[model samples]
Target: MVRPWIGLVVLSLGVVAAEPPKPVRVPLKAPHESTIPEGPVGEAIRLGQKVFTNTPLHAPKYSGNALSCSSCHLDAGKAPHAAPMVGLWASFPTYLPRAGRVGTMEDRINGCFLRSMNGKPLPTGSEEMRCLLAYVWWLSKDVPVGAEVVGRGNPPLQAPAPADPERGKAVYARACAACHGEDGLGSADVPPLWGPRSFNLGAGMARTSKAAAFVKANMSGLGGSDPLSAQDAYDVSAYFTHQPRPDFPDKVKDWPKGGKPADSRY
Candidate 1:
């Protein structure tokens, strides 16, 4: 049996363990909008912003789903935990273990096109691609090369359950149905969870773990506040990700050299 003082010391240790040390962010500055000079370059930058926000409207031919780039990136990729695109201009040409090779920044965007947007890859060197790249470049104009942004992607959290679809269905009814609809089809104010218009199986959201991480960060207010517990997030994510949605033809090509995670639908 432990003494009361020993128990208190253990509790104090647990509390200290809970708080993760903050990561040191690279010192870099993002260009201001007012800095955009009036000229063809400015016009292109503005167009790029539109492309990020109104993807389907601008690049209808390439879009296969209803989501715009802003859907996941959030606020045209400016929001922190939603994976801001601000410092990515200099971070690319890096190796992605998923691809098993060093790929250009355009490759990353095209990966989203194929998976998240459930769309065809934009033609190389197309006007649409140029505009999208320009917008990202402008966002990183003031950022120095080889620097990192503090909040570039969905923040991590405690490990969630392996996911039980049935439990998730009930959780969704209580917590998510209000915003995402009983059928999992989101309304005009929100993005759909699963449907013909939703992201394909190749999207990161399709993975149970990835969806759980995203839910941990933003389950309310369009990725603003999370009201559900970690287990609930995993359950709901598993249920929705397993539901019928578009399928990616190139799923067979992914993780070609092995090392696929357990939750991969393919």
Candidate 2:
């Protein structure tokens, strides 16, 4: 007969640790400019690209901040991990917890205007809205409805080490201040990270988790490389996200049914 200690060791040897789920990501497949079909529809796509790249020049009234859509969406929403417009047509008409209900594609675009741009929404029937929809639709063509696209958003960062805002001040000085400026007011080439022109508290990027993930992937800004350590990302993100910025009066209405993120300023 086996001894009790031997049986216990055998049982332990047979146990296996659970494996983590594999992350899903598909390669970005948005059409290139040469792929735009020839005709009025193609012209519309071109116009939409211009509008996306030059919001201040095209939709000034609807844009309050200096930040262009390209600033975050990079490459006119074609770049992966920059919230590419590809597959968006298939992803929308979905539920948003912040909206507390399902919403249309147009509704989602308007939400970006109010928070990310810190500006008024475009009219539903406006030429700008139509052109934008046309371009997004063209980009998303042939994508199956409800299919998740890889690189659609910033990759989720592992839960960061506890952040320290005090340490963040130094990190910002060393890494971020040159481009964003010590005051965070921004320059002609960079968008303000905080202050009146920056995204409001209701904006998703205002959260430390969201900001840190973005920092890890894209905060290289002009350099276009991620140089910050995970801890540095967490600390600096916390510091800047907590800085003064525009406030959204309607934030009180967010997550009306509950499930607010712990890091949400509102």
Candidate 3:
């Protein structure tokens, strides 16, 4: 009987020993850190500088043209009628009447290649594109995002006729040169009207067709006093289009191989 009692006690002890303990719950907290690395911002800016002036990215056919992003964007910051790329990233995914849709920064960059650069469109989600976006974001940090950018910091559009280049040159020299400089290398508030910083002949300055139509409806900045005539627009555009373009590499060896050539519209 004692032995049976001993066996029962042993069995009870075994059962107690075999039972699992209750699990304790602990709350988890996220670490205090940034998702992106600290140095990447600077790196992105550097990479953007590289991509801006690289013509090789256009490749094959457009290789003859020495144009780069800087060719139009200029110093990667201040440009007028061309849009200030500095604060651009914050406002993207914004609406564009031309496209009849909202577009992101990437969309705008690709559009530049197509419309302004006269090159093929870059692939979406590409590293080069992302770097460019990052640079723009970094530049635009202080500027408010999503604000409507009308007339590109200029006054309302004028219905007057365009000015002649011969006449406009005098106008540019007398009225505009104080701020824009003789060569249209504009000061801080004013932007360059020509040089690598100016708009492309095919896109912003294209006088023949669609681009001209856009300019006629939306051209701005006549000092809020005398509006430019249609002829004024044509002649000034001629002068700007004739301005020199910057030299950049003809081919991008680093671009991924087997990439398709951009569509003809670019």
Candidate 4:
């Protein structure tokens, strides 16, 4: 009986030892590949390319100049100052120290038009605006959407209305052509308003109305002489909006990150 009891105890202990420990759950890793396909996104990118170079639609304010969105953006939509036209749509509605508020891609583009293109703003919620937005979305494929992308420098003073393109042409002849050139292809020091070096409509000047407002408040330097009236700014913006964009190279380049350069005053 003692031997039997001992054997039973050993069996019970063996059964206990054989029992498996509770299963532990491990988290799955994120997929390395993108879910979005290249076909439709590619089409949108092509459309964006056209929009970027299409200046006649916005009707930039300056005249006697052939400046277009492509002038600065370089190649279909590549440039140093502006980020790559791809995989960036996912980030926006981000905080900007320059503007002192969170902004969308539209706000960034509007800011560019006023300061860089010297153009007027496009109205909010317009078809043109949406189309431009669509293009940006296409470029940013597979990236997280609506994340903040900080800019460089205090945002250019809010853009004002565009000057009349016809009048702007005259202004270009008198005031701008010497430095920007008749083609609006600025040199290294000046930076071209339209061409490979210019910002794309989608990436730079999509929001026409906002861009206009900014120009009205400040132009020709923040506190300098020769500030343009709202109407004058609008007209000039209209003229530049209509110009052609330059073609981008096959490979896109990276833009500088964060707001403002260390050496910048504003």
| lDDT digits (tens) for residues 194-254 of candidate 3 | 5665434335434322323333444435455345555555555545444564322322321
Where is model 1 more than 4 Å wrong at Cα?
Answer: 1-24, 27-30, 220-226
Which stretches in model 3 have alpha-carbon errors above 4 Å? 1-38, 54-64, 79-82, 146-202, 207-233, 238-266
Clash numbers, per candidate = 1, 1, 13, 74
Cα-based TM-score, every candidate: 0.85, 0.86, 0.48, 0.39
Q: Write the per-residue lDDT of candidate 4 for residues 1-266, one digit (tens) a residue.
A: 57998999998888844676544332212123253347855554455556567543444442112344554444434432233454456556687655557888887766555444545565567544565676666544434444333321113443343236797677555555677689977775454656655644433342333344434433433333366665655566656555665332211221234453221211
**In model 2, which range of ten residues has the least summed lDDT?**
218-227
What does candidate 1's lDDT look like per residue over 58-106, in tens digits?
9898888888999888778887777788888988898876777889988
Model 2 misplacement above 4 A: 1-25, 220-226
Ordered by lDDT, highest first, the candidates read 2, 1, 3, 4
Score each candidate by Cα lDDT: 0.83, 0.84, 0.51, 0.49
Best by TM-score: 2
